[model samples]
Target: MKQLLLVFTILFSPSFSAQKTETFKIKKYQIAILGDSLKESSGLNFFNGKLYTFNDSGNSAELFQISLDSAKIQKKLNTKLRNEDWESLTNDGENFYIGDFGNNLGSRKDLKIYKIPFRDSLVLDSTKTISFYYPEQKDFTPKNLNNDFDGEAMIFLNGKIHIFTKEWKSKETTHYIINPENFENQAAEKIETFKTDFVVTDASYFEDKLYLIGYTKLAKVYLIVFKKSENDTFFRETPKKYYLGSAFSLSQIEGIAVNKDGIYISGEEFHSPLGIKKGQFFFIPFSDFD
Candidate 1:
């Protein structure tokens, strides 16, 4: 009986069994061009299998819809919301939220966001706008290398709006939660923070995880993954470092969005001596991460 039991244990044990050991491998994706000369392509979101993106700075503030498979622009919707330093954008099932909160000088106080209904024929007059402001925090300039505190990335999750800062010179990220229902005088509660090796420009949530992409001073763009904990906080779960490579020929990569299809990245042209084009979009297929 002892000999029979030992044979059974050996056959059923995971270590001794013939079952294959599954290993997770990082996959490379082919970057497809959505558009060129985007004039600071800042935000990206997907709706019903199509891709939509907007410019961060410029007049008119056009929202562009593109075909993901063909990488072609299908339609351009001119939003009523003026682009006063438009930074980042996201969607919440019914409406699209555009953040006009690009406070670079660290002086402006009246930051705002625009909410537009998702439609096939959205006109400039049909858009709605909402404004928000952060409470005063003693008005101090960023003295250290990591003090730039303006953002272009805002997402609507669980009926609340969550904002992430675009650190111009910081390796750490601050998360704030806001009440979407009460836009005016919405004091952002600093919920949590995370540190990164690269400057985080933009982020998006997909598959129950948050993915942040940013560029380093060395001109390398990286992707960092974070998984949410039970306490409603997010913690970095990916390995130490993972490089997504450069965004086009430019280095200042900003926007990132993930869906069931794959990962999408955008860039604001880094300071170049050769005078490179301003903004562009690139994408990697979802299967690459699998």
Candidate 2:
């Protein structure tokens, strides 16, 4: 029996590992420089037939509309709200939500999301703020850069906001769900976790698909795609990953938006020993992955 079991283990192990280790290389179909105004563009979303993005922490509290044909800023709309490390954006056809819950130190208690009625107007002078805390997190003390409470990716689906944490220590992403109607301090319900081994910067949900963009600490770009289960949950299956080349070739990617035409990706400028890259936009056709 021992000899038979050993033979089965050896025969199946390699194939099983191969399934999880599979990665496809994707090249940028089109590249365009977004100029200095969007040097820190951290979130990407398509709304009203136009592409929109915004700066991350320590920059403007404004959102920008970029032209795909011209590859330049079409307009910059001020939000009149505090930036406060805004990292992600999502829209539900009526209103736009901005995530300001970038907790890199795992000590932040001021996580919030701004809801603006963008479908009615382009400029926002006010917004409804939704504050929340992770129910699974008990520690209020600072964990600095090693904390897993840090999150940069979020999406709105079926009246709920789905958030994915960028786990700094374990390199795993923990999923959470939040009620968008709740404005008072609320607890985010923990749902599932995925061992991504990379820091997720942004996420987009379109046509029953969850698309995520991230980069490793070494500046390697990655794209993860997950199909909703029969019950419409991502926890049911493992997402497939594609290695989208190095950040040097792709810039330090931070945002992703998917539409019927293609996938739109934006990266903030990166500077390191490897090299310096300008913030830019990239498009990948549906034919590349479909």
Which structure among the candidates has the greatest TM-score?
2
Model 1: lDDT of residue 37: 39
Q: Which RMSD values do the candidates have, in order?
A: 14.3, 8.9
Encode model 1's per-residue lDDT on 179-245: one tens digit a residue: 7667466677877766665556677888667777765544456767777665555764443346665
- Reference-based lDDT, residue 138, model 2: 87
Candidates' lDDT values, in order?
Answer: 0.63, 0.79
lDDT of 2: 0.79
The TM-scores of all predictions, comma-separated, are 0.79, 0.89
Name the best candidate (by lDDT).
2
Question: Where does candidate 2 clash, by residue pair?
Answer: none
* Cα shift from native, residue 76, model 2 (Å): 1.4
